[model samples]
Target: MPFDFSQSHFVLFGLPTTFALDRAVLDTAYRKLQAEFHPDRFAAADDAQKRLSLQIATRVNEAYQTLKSPLARARYLLQLNGVDTQEDTNTAMPVDFLMQQMEWRETIADAKTQRNVDELEELNRQLAEEITELTVELAELLDEQHAWSDAATAVRKLRFLEKLNDEIGNAIEAVLF
Candidate 1:
């Protein structure tokens, strides 16, 4: 396929190395790369070429996945800037954020226990809004201000919000079924 295998994910997809990306552009590039390097297209080629095609296809898929998810993209951006998120080693969060998390969890537990679908839905809405806000802040931190440490902290918070959102989804399913 004449593609550089060692390129970063964003470079592979011809994307600018920024937190704020256009989804439509990413989607188009992903599809174009997949079509260009699809292994099936190399079915008639020599074994060596076929293997290369397979590797290329695998890399393409991996890059697409990393670029598509906001959490993954944020982490990748931080990594590109030589900033380790330290998500595991740095578990210490602000007390106010911790308190807010506890409150949300308590609300979730109560609503789930009571099978209150409406409350669960409302909480889900609020969580979505918070996620959106954090994402915007991350875009500014990573793209505009180049605040790597602040971006890393924001990424950690985003991960927590995503996990909590998943829990809310599970609770909604439990209450429904």
Candidate 2:
């Protein structure tokens, strides 16, 4: 149980430290590591070894979660490259993007007020498309161009979009139920 907390998530998973990754490879590595570090495998070992196994298993889970999520992975990569996402410290965005966000919010509000599931579904579709586009841009910025600042900005946008998506899902559920 040689645990190295200093190792990056990618290093822990034997992955290249980059934004772009093969999902299959990541999933396979995660499963392999999970099985290897599973506490049950060390159940008969000494207390110290069992504790170490639990710690290693927890670390592996955390690494897998962060590496699997696009937004988290992007943020981690930016941090590794010496860029702070400034998710809390910096809220500034392009005026147009801000306006778009406001408009989307209004649209969601309208749909909720009217109890229109169809409208909510349409809005969800649009938001998903926007999220997909932003994800592609994020990958390009982090992997190909190494645009740290822009990548940080993109991460903020994705965070907002994800929140909005969750809200939309909640609203839809409310309307249906």
Candidate 3:
């Protein structure tokens, strides 16, 4: 309940305002904040206290979720710097990336139709590697270079990859069962 709602999520978690964060540190901070602001702790208090506690708990949970996710953290950092990703309206991606996306979708469809778990798993590994590489690049662009525009592009690409990754996961599940 000592939390200031106006503070940025990074400050709320006692973290630097950067895209790259230590998950362990975030997890620890989240646990501590949750323990302090948990609604049950204020159950015996007055209604106002309980309401405030619930609000703080909700904010803490939201901050924890945002920081824990790489893509979300990147987007949040961009927002903090007054850079809008414009994900909805700005859909112009590089041609190579669009081609790569098409290829990935084709591969996924084929793997799913054949129910090829091994193939799907291989595709998953490849996609994961690409994601990792992009994440590293994104960290450098946002934290080191301060290239907000490039970072926004990287975020858009990551968003596409994340969606495809979800589809791949579903395809794997369908193939399994």
Q: Pick the candidate with the highest lDDT.
A: 3
Deviation in angstroms for 88 in model 2? 0.7
Better of 1 and 3 by lDDT: 3
Best by TM-score: 3
Candidate 2 structure lDDT: 0.94
Model 2, range 1-177, lDDT digits (tens) per residue?
677889999998899999889999999999999999999999999999999999999999999999999999999999888999999989899999999999989988899989999999999999999999999999999999999999999999999999999999999998889
Clashing residue pairs in candidate 1, if any?
none
Question: Scored by CA lDDT, what does every candidate get?
Answer: 0.94, 0.94, 0.95
Q: Which candidate, 2 or 3, would have the higher TM-score against the true structure?
A: 3
Query: What is the C-alpha lDDT profile of model 1 across 9-110, one tens digit per residue?
Result: 999988899989999999999999899999999999999999999999999999889999999999999998899999989977889988989999999999
For model 2 the TM-score comes to 0.97
Candidate 3 positional error at 137, Å: 0.5
TM-score of each: 0.97, 0.97, 0.98
